[model samples]
Target: MSTRHAVRDDLDSRPWTGPTRRYDILKEGAIALAIVAVLTFGLSALFSSPDEPALTFKGWSQSAPDNMYATMVAEMSGSSETAGYGPPYNVNSDGLSIGPLALQKWFGVTHPIDAAQDFVIAPLQSQQQPDAVTAAVSQWTSASADQRTAWATAYEDALNDPAGANGDATKVPAGDYGPVPTLAAAVVAMASSGAYDGALASAGGHFFNTDNTKQTMLMGDGSYMDDLATAGNLQGNTWGMVNETGSWPGQQWLATYSFWYQLPMFNNEDPNNTVATVLTDNADAIIFAIMFVVILLFVFLPFIPGLRSIPRWIPIQRLVWRQYYREYGKR
Candidate 1:
């Protein structure tokens, strides 16, 4: 018989000579469970997890009112990031196109959002704006699109002046903003009442207001989260998403993918007009695509010609099973 066949037949005929020991599976399992439970509770109690409350518009508006108003103006002018976020949000990402790879646009506005209407006017209407605020909204709705744009632009420009310095609505100088200032001021007042947040949260399906999408989107301008994130090194530039704040080493494991977002092109709001910069603006998509390819390579490692041969060349598995090799003799 061939060596392999002889080895198999002998193994099949081999008698069991190993010693046996009594074992109580239930007892052993119970002990293991008890030990694990104790360790889990001890560790969890020792180091409490991040239990901060969810970020809310009320907190943001109260913390940074000027920033809120400026963001509102940006939304009205369609200059906010959400205004031009392209696909999935229903608007063009301003100019986030890449050599026909407008994948976001291809998906096409699954969740439509008109920033001005959704974030401001609708919320105000839901709160039942006071007569002055209501009149402003009425005038705003009745005006021609150009007139409304002109009004918002004028108001935003006025707010940009020294009086409106530091995003504070209290400082804005007099301007030809028509009813915009009235509407903006009223919205700011509504912020104090937190009606804006309530209106937005309640805007979801009548059955359940669990989805806080609109309320959350209102803070997308980034100013609200910047302070906390920067302090925690959580911003994209700090690679904060992957790293922990302070001296603690955060999830370094995520560095592999997050590395792409740290690149200047991806981090910058406008890194000039180069093609690389354009690609950077759409870094999320690019990174996802890259990760997909990497996953495909790993999944098909055995099928990939050159890559599949790496295991044979390196043979790291031998190191891992070195003791077994010594016991059985090397194949």
Candidate 2:
């Protein structure tokens, strides 16, 4: 009896040892990698690539039907980038003085694009008799602003009249228009000859074969951008630039900023659109700063006082080790 009692006491006091299996770390790692590979392959097959293909200037000029705006875009691609962009296009180095106050203006002269020389003259020079185009470019450049304006205005009016397809613009009443028509003709010829891309490339040190800048300028010139803006409900009416591409999620985080644009004060105000844009820009900066601070706080949360104590306050420890608690309680 004494021996049996002693054996029973030893069994009770001894540490509980159940499984004694060796863990192969290499085998576990290999198995994990295999599972990840299979999962990755399945996901890849399920989801395809996301690519937003854009049309180029050459493509649009070839395909787009003759419209008032389309012709305008084609014609204006030379000069429009001047009035359209604030600086770099115009060589306004002081434009970045506004900083975050005018975030758009802050990154000044980063891209030094001379619209007329790059878009118009360069493209024309790409073709045969480049010297002739160069001389014409020189004449246009030397002309007075009033002369250029007169020429541009007259040409713009000429475009308004119903015209032929991909041909010479109808004759303008011969006046002090100077070499305007010739320059305009040069542009048209460049477009017609499909050397427009060559001209644009010439401006970018003849390196960029892509027609992105040319196409963008073209789109803005014609009512293309206006049409797109209208279609996308980005017009000032439908709450300043909400994502209008049919049922797709918008800038979800910017919903509040968008909501401000819908207000009567913003909607009805004459310069509300500009005001809203500025406000949104400022608000975005503030929101970004707040988010950054929050992220930093989260990163160092373990060292934070109140946050570190949250685990104890919630007492999740008791639930996780409930069996150990029961055993301790029984003791």
Show model 2 residue runs off by greater than 4 Å.
Answer: 1-32, 51-53, 65-82, 92-108, 129-139, 153-189, 202-277, 280-331
Deviating ranges (above 4 Å) for candidate 1: 1-38, 92-98, 162-170, 204-207, 243-253, 268-273
TM-score of each: 0.80, 0.53
* lDDT (Cα, tens digit) per residue for candidate 2, span 1-331: 6998898768778996643458899999999999999998997787643333554455445554344223543343333534455554455333322224555455566555555456555666556645666676777778876766676666655554445223234544444545555665566556656666556655556564654555565556655456756776766447534564555545556554566555554344455477555444344444445556766777999789998889979988888879866866622
Cα miss at 178, model 1 (Å)? Answer: 1.6
lDDT of 1 by residue, 41-63 (tens): 99789875565576777777788
Candidate 2 lDDT score relative to the true structure: 0.56
Q: List the residue pairs that clash in candidate 1.
A: 66-167, 163-171, 244-250
Estimate every model's Cα lDDT from 0 to 1.
0.74, 0.56
Per-candidate Cα RMSD to the true structure, in Å, reads 5.0, 10.9
